[model samples]
Target: MKLMTKLSMTTLVASCGLASAAVADVKVGLIFSLSGPGAVLGEEMRNGVELAYEQLGGKLGGVDAELIYEDDQRKPDIGKQAAEKLVRSEKVDFVIGPSFSNVMMAVHRPVVRAKTILISPNPAPAPLAGEDCNPYYFAVPYQNDQPAEAAGTYMNDHGIKKVYLLAPNYQAGRDVMEGFKRTYKGEVLGEVYTSLEQTDFSAELTAMKAASPEAVFAFYPGGLGIQFVKQYDQSGAKLSTPLYTVYTLFNGAANEAVGDAGLGVYASTPWTYNLDNPANTQFVAAYQEKYGTLPSAFAAMAYDSLRLIDGSIAAAGSADDLKAVRNAMTSAPFQSVRGDFEFNTNNHPIESMYLGQVEKDENGQYVLSNQATIVEHMPDAYAGECKM
Candidate 1:
């Protein structure tokens, strides 16, 4: 592993040497929830970045890129601490993600104050794209609400009327619920916010059942999603109302844990293993070969984030010049596992979203299926509000 890493770093440095026509070392920092409830999501992201780094031979945009990875433990305070150390001490040229929204919010000020560019692979809480929109921050993935927006549209199209809403008590959870209601135009029987890492969802489920809504909409990611799906199924709710979700029950290790509980469930996303794009197919095959499992949406986003940064550095010819790098990244057009994507004015993606169904394959293994493109080059709510 050490030899592979050294070789990759050398290749990256060599590429950067060629691009700059001079030698330069570029530092990049990654902050993610590598432990706690969100560890699996962070691990997927870390794997994606690692794979990209290895494939690039340690060079991004023809520059020697040095990555410093730190775990946030899915806590806001810890993420802030990591951000401070990475920026003020280690002096990373660019930053990527805190995975969870609360952590991102905590890390944002220090990163922006340091004038370093933040390339968020996840954490699309509404504020960062709205009043807090910063010139240095960019998200390769769609905002947190985009998937929920698609779910709302699906419900609208299906003529569903009343629904109960459930999400964690946090910024991202609220963002998704609001986004869902924005498009559905249906009656929300009730809304419930559970503790951030709490495992028990029975009380919330009981309330949801009491409302007797036509459908149940939720936004639970990582381990919470797995627990919710299992409990929802065990509660016998599946026998009655359908569960409509955004990034809740889908593919990857999460789906594997969900098992038959997630079967027939519907969720919305911008990418899936079943997507018919050439890029997606290649990514899936390569990832499966390397890791012995298909890549998750988080993994795909991380891969794109690295490639995007590489493209930006290549375009600007210097990762050391963060302002130039940021500008290049903002305008860079790059290929992703999800196919073509470009940043909107808010530094968030204007990309496609799909409604996917969870089902078992012939092996009786759970997988994502029926990926239907619901929106393309979709605009976020904050688009009209952003001046840049």
Candidate 2:
């Protein structure tokens, strides 16, 4: 709540015409994995929101904003608790949550059931984009399979036949490989699913090297990704074949952690810090200024999440009607840090996807150089399956 020392009620009401009655505080809850393996991503997601709130002059929906944070610890049950608390007790209008698909699948139903808008910065599971789509849920990032599909397209277009696939034996890990195979017209040299908790990949790396595929595509995010790159480089695999992913480049530290090992690695992404656009230019500058480091795709998408909400609030003139705000968001002019944005009928994003190669910048820092546009204005494949 903001204190108005000398301002009259009329002045307060006039300044923000979003409310018919006196404008009250807007509460937004955040649920992310603030502990365990995903802490870095969760921290960045929160950082993105904080930077967004600061840039927006500390107001949301034309009212003083109240942000409540809940740490999911990268677990589904904990995430469910966070969602219940935010909905049942805090009564927050919206929740920016779900860093991982496991947690997202766990908490999505309950939060949507309660009529609170649940916005996920990452992990737009294909299930939610199709038969299970919910109007109350909004995925700020591209659909989980979108980038993977783009990677598959890149390989197919470039005629990279005989590729090996690897990922953690989890929902998101499986989804990416599935998406890759969905578009890839290539020989599957081999397919490997590793344990989510597996730290060392000596066995898997040996197996991949034996297959001797033209290329390798793997989805081992978080610390696992960092480890995978380092191991792949050490296993003498990088000398023979290249590494590709849709996950590693999204995290800022992954580049630094892998360092020279990451060179020549290609990633498929929807947003990169290098995108040249008015919004992106401003965001990259502001984010670096505020965070004292380069922003990741996780941060970019979260920052865009609030910006879209701000635009929706302005168009709807109030957040009292949740559906109205959602309608305004979808139908309104979609400007994002990624240039243009649109939502499919299922509330998934319809946007351009790109292929980026890890290269050194002028400062000798590792950066994902935009290689080419893999897919433009690409709609998710499951859009047709969505009843909504």
Query: Against the true structure, whose lDDT is highest?
Result: 1
**Residues 1-388, model 2: lDDT tens digits:** 0112113223433454433222446777788777788877877787787778777766776666656678888889989988998899988888888778888998998899998888888888889988999888888788888899999999999989899999998888888988898999999999999988887999988888888899999998887888889999998899989899984444576678789988989999998888999999998899889767778888888888877778888788887777888788775344688986788788888899999988888888777878889989998888899887
- Which ranges in model 1 have alpha carbons more than 4 Å from their true place? 1-24, 362-364
Question: How many collisions between residues are there in candidate 2?
Answer: 0
lDDT of 1: 0.82
CA RMSD, predictions in order: 3.7, 5.5
Candidate 1 residue-wise lDDT, 1-388, digit = tens: 2234335445654655432213337777889887778888888888788778777767778766677778888989989998999899988888998799999999999998898889888887798898888898887788888889989998888899999999999989999998998898989899889888788999888888888999999888899999999999999998899998976447578889888899888888888787778877878888889898878888888988998988888888876676787888888646788775777889888888888888877866677775678888887888767665
